[model samples]
Target: MTITFVHLESVHHKLSKASHKADPFSDARESGLDIRYATISDAFPLDHDRDLHREKYWTTLLQIFPSYVDEFVRKLIRSDPQSLHFLVADTVYVWPTAIARKYNLINVSFFTSPAHVFSLLYHLDLLKERGHFLRKDDAVDIDYVPGVGSMRIRDLMASLSKRSDITGNTLFKAFEEVKKADFILHNTVEELESDTLSALNKYQPNYAVGPINLSEASSVAVSRSLHAEVDITKWLGSKPAGSVLYVSFGSVVQTSKEVIGEIAHGLRLSEVNFIWVARAHLTSSGDSNVLPDGFVEEVGDRGLIVPWCDQISVLSNPAVGVFFDALWVEFGGREHVVRRSDDLFPSDLRSADGQEVGGW
Candidate 1:
């Protein structure tokens, strides 16, 4: 069957470049799958400009991308009518499954983060009961997560508040949407997060088809011509194993000045080689001057602070030992919980072709 990959406009640009680089045209064409990219064209206003907090951002996104949403529905109807549509976007925003059953298209929502993170987000109510969620400047220990041992409240992202505020309520709503998905696709391998994967399977069909390092195996000849600027693979090839800490907060998370300093200190104290992608501009309500004075200079050759970098290539490298980033409540926590590959494919589940039989 044909699969049309739908993503938000911004994500579409990035994923398209990555996909083309990963296979050129021959790979996608040979799979008997026609890969088509489409995006809803709308930009939600900044959170601060709208006077909305973190939670309300979701509601604002729904409003800003109404046309994109309508286009999604129309595209499915026009495409194959019976073909499955694979949607890979920030599930917090582009949840097409709400309308999937109505259109007879199977909606597969891909979570680039860990399943445990989504699990915690899904059980926001339970977290609230155990006092796991905390308000601004409030501290609490996160000891209830399925696989993660324990994390301090301050160590958690500020967005994990249990209060009945706009952000909290909106997040809870998003979890409801997650529950209705046809299947959940996580960008983490089974080797890293088994317990969380098992917990997720009890609720919905799940797949751990990642590290999602398709870009790592792409031909350099095709990639060089496809995109301009830096070669992240070259940089990663130079680092030592388990020495460099890969730091990024995806595309949406914004870190505050205080938290940034704290992170720099944590990295320094940890005494690990690091690569930090720190955005100068603030997309959300937070200060960007969080890095300590002379932080970059102090770290010098040991640390590289760039505005943006290729995450897939960097993460796939053997030199990079640990991945570090601020744990936004939206991102679950700092723990890197993932499932092992062997755990994902049980003997009974394998087809004659040796592929997993059940769809996820």
Candidate 2:
């Protein structure tokens, strides 16, 4: 199969290419797939004059996407690669799927999250029709997502749970596009999301392609340094095997200084050894000041804070006991205690109606 990827030639796209430097496509050409890149200069250009509004940005992208993908595919076919056996793209850009249909090619749309999240997004329009999209003050905050378990309003994608017009509108656009794709690629594995995957109907055949656990040296696992103050490798090595807790909240989630302080206080109170990968952009002051006052003194060599480091390498270190994508929700003015997955989801949802939501 010749797998062609049609994408924008943007800086972020270049970075993603760098991340996938070890292209299985190039290597696996003899194995099965003959890969091709059909890229254009910044297909969805952003505004330089002002900050881009999310809703306007996505709407504009969608408006322009069909024509762009149509041209890209037609040109590729004219060049004669025997027609694209498979065309893949981010689910957010559904134009490729439409192009695939025109050219009689298989379209695989990628979702870079879990099957449960994908399921929620897939049924978002239906939820809206059923009047279940958002909570009314008169109504309860709890609702059952089709494939996923009982979802608390606080637990919904921060966008849908809140009254964010931009995110909700853009999200609706993205998922609506997803439904038209012939195939969906989820970033989670089958066992972890077996029930949710099963719930995907015949309309769109889905695959559990990842939860892509790559090694530090894996071609796809490239790292760029942000904070170089402390040596994370040396720090993790100093601790005992499986003794240190690793805390990081990923890139998108903006965490407050007060919450980080609370985490520091909790770590101090627990008196545990831990490595905290604190990204500067996530903090209020964009510095280690996010740590609570007297935190460094109190923890006293038990904690190591860095702006950024190779998370994969840190997790691979024998000293890492647990790696948590920590989340802290604010409610009732004060910050509610941060909960790990193990704390919140102790059991799976009932599998009735083929709806398997573990921890539902």
Candidate 3:
């Protein structure tokens, strides 16, 4: 059966470029799955200033795009009643399952964040009831989480507040929708989060079919093509194992000059070889030169700071010992949380039979 993947145009543009370079559809085609991308931009003009317009433009976009989404669904339903629809992630799949149910579309939801993070958000009401809503300091110890070690309240708080701001008060709506999906796919590995995955399996059919990072398997040609001028993978190949610290905070998160300076200081204190991708205009303050004076000279050849670089290529490199970024606490909190190598690749890397394997 064919599958139609519907996503926001802004996201699709990036993914289509990546997918074309990666040729992900070729694998699907080889497996007899006809895949196509349907984007909102195909149906309506996008407001580049959607955030500025706020609810007015948001409602306008929804009204305009639902028909486009519905039409795509209708075409898929007509082409093959059994055609499946995959939504990339919670943020992109803003429509209701009722719409899919009306069209008889087999809707599956994908979550790019860790499952434990979702579970925490799913129980946000409970956390709030227990006096965990907003805090002045950005850090707090989060206990009672399933499958994984404790998370700082600051990290949890940031996610919760940010979700509320972006999606309004219904924080659990996405997780609730995910549970009702035909199936759920997580961009994580079972071994990396076996405990959390086990807990999630009790509620729904969930698959931890990731690190979902294609960069690890990407060819040098694809990497160079995607990144344009900078060939990070080739440069990383020359570095020693566990020498470089890869730094990135996805595409959306922003950091201030003070926080950026702190991070630079922290990295210098850590004394690790690093590649820092400092995107321009990260803050309106325009104090992008947040690094400590003589910091680069101190590290010498041990550090490289570029304005932008391909993240996946950097993360997969053997030289990358840690991935560091400043954590923002939107609500209130003083403590910052960092994800260590162990967190990404959990310690219990062996299977039940004691065979050496890679994963959770």
Q: What's the TM-score of each model vs. the native? A: 0.67, 0.70, 0.71
Which pairs clash inside model 2?
A: 149-360, 347-359, 348-358, 348-359, 349-357, 349-358
lDDT of 3 at 166: 42
Q: How well is each residue in 2-102 modelled by candidate 3, as lDDT tens digits?
A: 55555566555555464454443445555555675455663434435433334454555445665666666676667765535443445234565756678
> What's the lDDT for all of these models?
0.58, 0.61, 0.57
Of the candidates numbered 2 and 3, which has the greater TM-score value? Answer: 3
TM-score, candidate 1, is 0.67
Alpha-carbon deviation at 123 in model 2, angstroms: 2.3
Off by over 4 Å in 3: 12-33, 42-67, 82-92, 135-142, 148-152, 155-157, 162-164, 167-172, 214-229, 284-300, 325-360
Task: Please state the error at residue 344 of candidate 3 in Å.
Answer: 18
> Considering every candidate listed, which one attains the maximal TM-score?
3
- Tell me, by lDDT, which candidate is best: 2
Root-mean-square deviation per candidate:
10.6, 7.0, 6.9
Weakest 10 consecutive residues of candidate 1 by summed lDDT:
336-345
- Compared with the true structure, the alpha-carbon lDDT of candidate 3 equals 0.57
Candidate 3 or 1, higher lDDT:
1
